[model samples]
Target: MRSIIAFFLFIFLIHSVQAAPLLQATISRESQVIGNDGVTHTSVFQERMYRDQNNVWLERVLPKHHQHSTDAKNKTSHKHLDLSETAQHYFLDNKKSTRLNLVLPEDKTVIHLQTVDIEMLGLTNCWTCVFSIFDSQSVKKMKITQQGNGYTWYESQNAKNKIKIKWAKLQPDQNPHPTSEYYATMDSIWKIHLERICRLWGLNLVKE
Candidate 1:
């Protein structure tokens, strides 16, 4: 009789847990990276990600806008070659979070890290799962204020150059995929890179 009662209780617990939805957060950030090589890079990256303590995955396409690079050695001519790409990323916690395995099925890449790392945004992950704390707002590790549609963030400021590294997070129900609007935005930012396509279609970059 005790065994029967315990079995029913266990079943009830499982059903109650299943009824609760997973906790997911979307983190979006736009900022400039000042390289030690004396070059600055501007990137606008948005990610729609999912996480529930132990499981995480890239659900949909996240928008990305990255301006090309420059080197002080080549500062005279400053060649900017913007690039655009598409991919997906997923991760599963296996006993530990620091020893998580990052899976980029789209690019056929898997990384087994020794420790939790919070670096290289919008590059390594297919879409964006979690790069240490990047997928979470706590990644900022700095003070922020409530902004119009999102929270204003800044980890540091370059007073000499008058540039304050800023970031923001906007919560929206819409998931942006590889839609026409996305292409138009990328097409404008990378006009030179997409010159061939623009020429073929005889279309000009939309200028605001």
Candidate 2:
């Protein structure tokens, strides 16, 4: 009886460790835009993410302290926005096949999608891959080119859109905080932009 109780205690401890939540926070993000008029503008923001096993929550931090609105008559209105309202939650299940549930906070709506491809389950940890799963057709057409150790370049078939990413190096004793910088160019509209990630936590880097 003593040996059996010890075995059960060990199993419970393993389960508790596996159920721990991972918190990922992006402290800052800088975005630079160059328009056709030869003008450049830059903006910065922050984001937070949390993952508990198969569920993840992504929150985009709005720069404004209050949510602003304009009436039909062009009148401006301001209202305080709750931080909790900014999160979009994702739930993934891979029991038999890959399945996803995207929950939108504003409308309290749940979007469900399922696929037979098992590989899709592994991509939930990536920032881009989460959205790419919704548009697998477009992802198939895009070409990926690796420049070197931490640089990746992507281009459209028409060459009208291009994106380059610089990934951060892995650190010791961490759950993989994969911060990155993105440089995107849209030749069709003569626009170029650079988005840099200042800090990140929790997400794993999957190099394509």
Candidate 3:
């Protein structure tokens, strides 16, 4: 009787370990057109968060360039992106959203609240891969294309300031599927931008 009880207990523990619940989440994205002239602009904001799970959020925002200018005295030039003096309001959900502004001026009119179909990246809830039973190979191999608006926002010295947004609809290295190719290709592109942005904003993404 004792031996049987111990055996059952061990089996129950094993089952419990293999049957953990998956994390639930909600992801959203948005875009905006700014500046009075509207000739130069930026858009594209994305957010990912867990709804049923603990509070976790990741966000990325991009603002457009308004106008480019140069300083006469120093012969140095700077691009003056346009903005009102209001914080731009972007609704991520029915009750949740965020307010964002350009980084340079730090004080300007924010793009107002508007209904825009900003392409947001939705997280794949694949926590089950922790269990040996769940097939995680597909998640690793399968690729999805996230199509949406893209833009560049920056401030630079007049002579060297050249901003261009180059995004790949597909990647360089060929994949069995076109979709999968961009998956591997996008990392390098994103890394370059992230590094540049961090340097320009005086922010250290990786801790020393």
Which of the numbered candidates is closest to the native, going by highest lDDT? 2
lDDT of residue 162 for candidate 2? 51
User: For model 2, what is the alpha-carbon lDDT of residue 103?
Assistant: 38
Per-residue lDDT value at 57 in model 2: 54
Candidate 3 segments whose C-alpha is farther than 4 A from its true place: 1-94, 97-107, 116-208
Candidate 1 achieves a global lDDT of 0.31
Regions of model 1 farther than 4 Å from truth: 1-20, 23-26, 34-40, 58-95, 107-109, 116-208
Candidate 3 TM-score to native: 0.19
Over 1-208, each residue of candidate 2 has an lDDT whose tens digit, in order, gives 0011212111011111233434444445566667789777777656555554544455666656744466788765436333334344454443522244433344343334344322343324343344221233443465766546654444443345454333333455333222443445552222222233223344343211
Worst 10 residues of 1 by lDDT: 190-199
Which digits, one per residue and each the tens of the lDDT, describe model 1 over residues 155-184? 322333221223334235322111111111
Cα misplacement distance, residue 151 of candidate 1 (Å): 9.1
Residue 2 displacement (Å), model 1: 50
Clashing pairs in 3: 41-64, 42-64, 84-108, 84-109, 85-108, 85-109, 86-109, 86-110, 88-110
Pick the TM-score winner.
2
